[model samples]
Target: MIEMFGLEALSNSAQAATTVGIVFTEAIALYIGYGAVTQIVHQATREFLGGE
Candidate 1:
């Protein structure tokens, strides 16, 4: 199934490590993205509410 994507045949441990690394990388990316969006919305909301 995996090889169908033209990926090299990695061992089980290697595959697991690769999956974990990919997930960790994506988690960090999503966290940063959401944090930035939240900050922007927070600032906008505060200004709309006339907060200093």
Candidate 2:
């Protein structure tokens, strides 16, 4: 029984770790995507306004 409990705990830990990793990866991707988009928009706005 103890062994089974330990196995279950380990499995849960692994699943949690995987979930965290996926979320972290997605957050980084989004941050990079938004940064790129913001730069594009900023450049476009500057061009539209005829600013240097």
Candidate 3:
């Protein structure tokens, strides 16, 4: 999969870099999406959780 991106198909350096980049991107996007959802439902979420 990583090799198909015209990148070096190596087990040592390139593969590790690609894997790291993919995981980092995914984690960042997930956090951003959660933040947006939380902001959108800030009031309702507080009420549902018995908060102020």
lDDT for model 3, please: 0.84
Is 1 or 2 the stronger prediction by TM-score? 1
What would the per-residue lDDT of candidate 3 be over residues 8-48, giving only the tens digit for each residue?
75666878888799889999999999999888799788989
Query: In every candidate, how many clashes are there?
Result: 0, 0, 0
Off by over 4 Å in 3: 1-8, 46-52
Q: Which ranges in model 2 have alpha carbons more than 4 Å from their true place?
A: 1-10
Off by over 4 Å in 1: 1-8
Provide TM-scores for the models.
0.85, 0.79, 0.60
Candidate 1 C-alpha lDDT tens digits along 1-52: 3355444588888777777787798899999999999999999999999997
Which model, 2 or 3, shows the larger lDDT?
3
lDDT winner between candidates 1 and 2: 1
Compare the candidates by lDDT and give the number of the best one. 3
| Candidate 3, residue 50: how far the Cα is off, in Å | 12
Candidate 1 yields a Cα-based lDDT of 0.82
Which ten contiguous residues of candidate 1 have the minimum total lDDT? 1-10
Report model 1's TM-score to 2 decimal places: 0.85
Report lDDT per candidate. Answer: 0.82, 0.78, 0.84
